[model samples]
Target: MTQPYVVRYVGGPLDGRVDSLPATPEVPRQVVTYVHLHAGPKIVHIYELSYAVEYGCEYVLRVEDE
Candidate 1:
């Protein structure tokens, strides 16, 4: 069994959020279908996994064109 690890999220509505997720054989490059419901229509956000020396492993929200 693989050990669980901590992953940080940046950008989007989930910015500055940390979560512990179960280990998978391969970590997906991007996480999709994150739904956020407010007073209006639900919004969907996608976060991409990134690695850096300073930030380590984190998921950054994908910026959409306006």
Candidate 2:
């Protein structure tokens, strides 16, 4: 079965961090496609990521804009 991307909030002023999925290598990889902000909280800092998936072990890099 296709694995779903996982989202985990590490910690931050803006809700939290986002972690991609596969959960583990054993599962089939999946593209994040996009992060639809269902509900954006009021915060000072926030980040966004977007792109296409062409291979395995894809990553969604995140860094502070400031």
Candidate 3:
């Protein structure tokens, strides 16, 4: 079956080099397990080389609710 999700190009700038699984509105920060980037019948798949998350400053401020 065709996948219900799709990857879109969101052009912007990050503080440093950043690369990870394709993200969607529902799964923000979700590391992608696989992807198909080619158009039409052809397809491509990509998997994570690493799983990562930030645990400092930004994450610290949000911990008060916990």
Taking every candidate in turn, the Cα RMSD to the unseen true structure, in Å, is 2.6, 9.0, 15.1
Off by over 4 Å in 1: 1-4, 22-25
Taking the tens digit of each residue's C-alpha lDDT, what string does model 3 give over 1-66?
A: 433323332221211333333332453433332333455674433222222343111101111235
Each model's number of backbone clashes?
0, 0, 0
lDDT of 1 by residue, 1-66 (tens): 877766788888898898776874274556644799899998999988887577567888889899
Q: Largest lDDT belongs to which candidate?
A: 1
Worst 10 residues of 3 by lDDT: 55-64
Report residue 36 deviation for candidate 3 (angstroms). 4.3
Note the Cα lDDT for every prediction shown: 0.77, 0.42, 0.29
What's the TM-score of every candidate structure? 0.70, 0.24, 0.19
TM-score of 3: 0.19
lDDT of 1 at 32: 49
How would the candidate models be sorted by TM-score, starting from the highest? 1, 2, 3
Residue range 1-66, candidate 2, lDDT tens digits: 867664443223324444565555554433322344446853333333333344333334345569
lDDT of 1: 0.77
TM-score pick, better of 1 and 3? 1
Q: Candidate 2: misplaced stretches above 4 Å?
A: 13-42, 47-66
Judging by TM-score, tell me the better candidate of 2 and 3. Answer: 2
